[model samples]
Target: MKRICILVIVLYVSMTLCGCFGPGISDYRYDLATGYQLICSSAHEIKVVPKSSVGIPMIPAKVVEIVFDDTFILAKQLGLKKESENSTYMIPDEKVIRYWIINAKENKIYGPFENDEFNKKQKELKISDSLKLKDVDSYKKSK
Candidate 1:
């Protein structure tokens, strides 16, 4: 009876231990390779909101690499007003624009255009209480 009990306990322990080595997400995924789906935990998805001098243009984007990935990122914006005198188009009906990226979570800026004054109104936005970035070496030692 004692041997039987020990065997049952050992089998239960082994079964639990075997599950620990099951499938787990790696740091990165290579979808192009092996022709199989890959999921990664470390890889993060980000989006950029491009801007133009005239205003925000309609463009489709998929991915972007952030220079710095920190919880607390600061965003500075500027507003532009277009004036047309005598229909001469002082600002030109179509003016050149520059593009910049916005966070994926930030969708208000890309929500929709109410009127021509969309880009004319600029505001400052920031994300606080985010985990600041640290070098790889420093991160390993961090608690």
Candidate 2:
């Protein structure tokens, strides 16, 4: 019947659309000492803890999009070799002044923002800061 055919067509279209917007693959982590955290989806959707007056208060994170070249600069700043295969680096506790997001895919730098600027940018983005930093145990669990 015509109704049956229409129902089947609608079902097929719905299934197709669902597939297009399926769940994304992402990685999340936090730095042990500074409590800086990052969530990366597709190497583009990167979010970090916004600068705040309180030290290590785990809320109000900010999102920034970085490009590929920034990764190299970050490595250099962190005393990493440009061609090193290692992906993660930790900063000394005393030097943990600002957090940054390096977009490995596009090679752009996003942060090094002061607390006030970071918070301002977060407001401009209009994104809720629901993401939280993973403690040492939680970070280890992910690995």
Runs in model 1 deviating more than 4 A are: 24-30, 33-37, 40-143
Record all residue pairs in model 2 with backbone atoms less than 3 Å apart, i.e. clashing: 67-106, 67-107, 67-108, 68-106, 68-107, 68-108, 69-107, 70-107
lDDT of each: 0.30, 0.38
TM-score, per-candidate, Cα-based: 0.23, 0.29
lDDT of 1 by residue, 1-143 (tens): 99999999999999888767644333332221111212222222112223223343222221211122321122212222245544532231222322232332332233222223323322333333252323222211111
Candidate 2, superposed: residue stretches over 4 Å from native:
1-95, 101-109, 140-143
Task: Tell me the alpha-carbon RMSD of every candidate.
Answer: 19.7, 15.7
lDDT score, candidate 2: 0.38
Worst 10 contiguous positions by lDDT, candidate 1: 30-39
The local distance difference test score of model 1 is 0.30
